[model samples]
Target: MPREVTSFSNALVKQARGLRDKKNRKREGLFLAEGLRILTEARETGVLPQTLFFSDASHRLLKELIDEVEAAGGEAIETSADILHKISGKDNPQTVLGMFPAFDTALDAIDRASAPLWIVAQSLRDPGNIGTILRTGDAVGAGGLILVDDSADPFSVEAVRASMGALFTQKIAQARWEDFVAWLRSGPGQLVGTSLKASADYQDARYEKPAFILVGNEQAGLPAAYEAECDLLVKMPMLGRADSLNAAVATAVMAYEVINQWRRR
Candidate 1:
């Protein structure tokens, strides 16, 4: 039996809605996630939300989820569609919404040798691009994503929604550029960067095990200093008028190239 919340002014609803802001999320140490499918992915990964809200329209669909949350000592609330929309800040919100504590994103938490490939992004600002990169990491069987410098928050609602559930499936880490460089050097890893000035064609590069594919800021591209740090800098061919690919797109291209190279060995 879950509690019922009908008013948008309810304290819990207000708190959940505030999670949409990065400051509030940091203060509360929790983030909001919407939709049954995404919540299911989190549950499957052994993560139960601290709080769950659902409307009558979604009751049947979220019955099991509600039960599981209650069983795990979490709060499950039955709310109205209007309340759901208020919490989610969407015109047509998902039937279900959840508040999950933020994950540990420290660079030291990552095990570098656990997987043969990892995706790294530096100074990326778009939440959508970050989400797409996470999806690509999951697709290419990369261990996780290591966000270097001031990348966008992966836990933001836009990023979470764009991930399409891949967020739960991959590990995420954030580190300063120097700290990340130090950490990678401390372990068994190869740093491969994507750059327009690089002479090596992406397809021709030899991608060693534990390859780290690094992409830079969307517009500024990789800084010369950062490119200089890479063991190998590879460039993708721009056959048309476009000089460069989208940051996330360039990452996906480089990631698959690494995977392909490893597969041939």
Candidate 2:
């Protein structure tokens, strides 16, 4: 029988609650992974869970899922809805929240990747943008996501929720801007950046070899100096009044463009 935690003051509940803040995530090197589907996907993708928290309110809906986790050698515990709210920071906490290690990787060591598409993000601070980009990266079978400078933490609760477990499924790494630039120049893949001014339309660019595409922040876009580093600069044409697109939406459109082009060849 999984131990039932009746109160919101339990040690585990307190720790899970910490995931609502980025500081706690950084300090603990952990994050709260909520919902059955996301947690299950994380488990399937080789994320070793620290604990499996099941709410009493959610247990009826998730009993079988909880059992499945236990079957897979994960620890299962029961806590009430109040405790779950304290831990998960949602109006209605999902039936399940699993604590998983904060995944961290470096871009320097890997010489090349097997996947065809690649994504590079520059100082993207929005959690939603980071999550959506990760999802798009995974959807297009991107080689990985490159994080430069102070990008949003993918392990944060909002990003994890937004990603729908795509964060766990994708390969992501953090590096400095200089290192990323050097990587692009040193590696065999073509590095492409998006710009509103560039004459080259995104659809026109050919994604040959292992290719890397840079996704800038929502408002600022990539810095001009970095823009010069692109093997080529590409832009999405806009007929509407809006001068540009949201970073995440732009990234999705650009990523799948490469996917479509690659499929033809």
TM-score of each: 0.97, 0.92
Candidate 2 lDDT (Cα, 0 to 1): 0.81
Best by lDDT: 1
lDDT per residue for candidate 2 within 1-265, as digits (tens), equals 5778887777877887887889998899888888878876776776657677876534443675566667767677887777777788789888778887787677864446678778889999998888888888888888678888888888888888888889887888889999877776776888888898799988888877688888887778888988988887998989999988888898888888888998898
List the global CA lDDT of all models. Answer: 0.90, 0.81
User: Runs in model 2 with CA error above 4 Å?
Assistant: 56-74, 109-111
What range of 10 consecutive residues in model 1 has the weakest lDDT sum? 55-64
For candidate 1, write residues 110-229 as lDDT tens digits. 987788899989989999999999889989999889888987889999999988788898899999999999898987888999877889998988988889888899999889999999
The TM-score between candidate 2 and the true structure equals 0.92
- Which candidate has the top score in TM-score? 1
